[model samples]
Target: MKKTILIVEDEDILREIVKDYLLNGGYEVLEAADGNEALSLFEEHEVHLVILDIMLPEVDGWSVCRRIRKSSNVPIIMLTARSDEDDTLLGFELGADDYVTKPYSPQILLARVKRLIESRYSTKHRKAAEDALASCGIDVHFPSRTVRLDGEMIRLTHTEFEILTYLMQNPGIIITREQLIMKVWGYEFTGDDRTVNSHIRNLRHKLGMKANLIVTVIRSGYKFEAKR
Candidate 1:
């Protein structure tokens, strides 16, 4: 079956360009010229992924992403004209799976789409295994990227949840910060440890005092410890 991708972009030329590439790549393409239309299409279709533009006529991408996150965990790749780091971070916070700057190569964008789709499926399979092991108390659905604690839902950013899941899977063993950067972010050369710290702070805050479940390894890094 062809995977469906919804492109919520206002640029008619750019939208058609992307739609064509996706169609050639064997994906079903759905295009929306505004946020309202995007939402309508979303509600009416089983979209496998979304490529959302930050600027729109009615609601803008951030607002659109916020509304979408309220009901769905569908993979989103945000498109931005600016190269601002803060914008990318905000998109990540709003559950975007990836971000692409404007004037990007169509081939590169297509590659990114293929990569994210594969990752989504692979993560789904891994989560099934993790769910079996984490069956009762805390359920972490990797593909859908939702977490449930004691049957109550918790909101977490992509990196935060990814880091938490990695630690949980390797409980009792000391996993270094570098290892975490590579594992959680899928890349190690971003040249900022602050990203890791920021995610940890947010994760701990979300987990509350049970933050103790993640232990700092003094000089080495950190590890996950199940509370007794």
Candidate 2:
């Protein structure tokens, strides 16, 4: 089945340009002039991925992302004209899978769309095959896509969930930032270390008492080691 991509941009030219690219790439394209329309379409369709602009009319991208995350783990790539690190971190904190700045290449944007869609579906397959991490009191329920610490449910954004799962899958082994980016983002990461660090920080904050399982290796990367 051809994946569906929702494009939420107030700019007419940019929206159509991305739509043209995604359509040419053999994916179904949905256009939303504002966040309200984006949310309506998302609720009505089985959208595979979303390319959402940070600026919109009637509503904004951040609200749209937060609302969608309440019920689904869909991949969301945030678009913004600003290059501020805080905005980027905020996007990740809200469960965005990727972030792209404006004045970017349409081809590169298309590539990111494809990669996120592919990663989401492929992970579904893997999750179905084998699931759950019951070690160290923190558990991941893959089928329902939920995590719990000692019986209390923990809410995590899609990216944070994936990152924690990857670390838990290889306890005691250091996973470089490059490796985490590849495994979760499903591509060679050209972004700086700050990107991964921001996600990890959010993940640890969410994990609370169980956060100690994730250890940052000095000058290396991160590892998950449960101390019994």
Candidate 3:
């Protein structure tokens, strides 16, 4: 079955270009000129992934991302013209799976879409594992993808959940940022180490007192300490 992708961009030419590339890449493509329409289409369609632009009419991409995230973990790759680090960070913070700066290769964008869709479907079986990790009042249920700290349910984004899962799956072993990116975000991700750091920071903050479980190994990477 061909995966469906929603392309939300205000620019007509760019949207058509992306749609063309995605079509050529064997995807079912949907187009929206603004965030409002994007949200409408997202709600109405069974979209496998989203390619969203930051600047839009009626509603901005950030709001759209947030709205979609409230109900779905569908992969979202943000498109932005801004080169600022803050912009990229904000996108991740809003639960975006990835981001691409403007003037990007359409082929690269299509690759990202393919990777994200594949990753999403590939992990569906993970929720059926029925295995779990529990220690020091922090409990993670792999099947349910739920976390609890001292009996209190903790909310975590998809990225955060994956990072915590990978860390706990290999306790006491130092996992490099590169490894985390490859395992959690897939190989096509072009973001740097700071991207992993940002997600780790958010994950740790949510873990609160249990945050120490994720230990930073200077000059190397991070480790999930089984005890400390």
Winning model by lDDT: 2
Clashing pairs in 3: none
Alpha-carbon lDDT of model 2 = 0.87
Clashes of each: 0, 0, 0
Q: Estimate each model's TM-score.
A: 0.79, 0.88, 0.85
* Candidate structures ordered by TM-score, highest first: 2, 3, 1
* Global lDDT of each candidate: 0.79, 0.87, 0.86
Strongest candidate by TM-score: 2
lDDT of 2 by residue, 1-228 (tens): 888898999999988999999999999998999999999999999988889999889899999999998978788999999989889888888888899988899999988887776656654455444766777889888866789988898877668878998998898999998888888887667578888998898889988888888999998999999889
Instruction: State the lDDT of candidate 1 residue by residue for 130-172, as single tens digits.
Output: 5533632667766566787777888765556677888888888
Off by over 4 Å in 3: 123-155, 188-190
* lDDT score for candidate 3 against the true structure: 0.86
Better of 1 and 3 by TM-score: 3
Count of clashing pairs, candidate 1? 0
lDDT of 3 by residue, 1-228 (tens): 888999999999999999999999999999999999999999999998999999999999999999998888778899999999889999988888789999999988887787776755655553344467887788988655678999998877667888888888888999988888888877666667778888888888989988898999998999999774
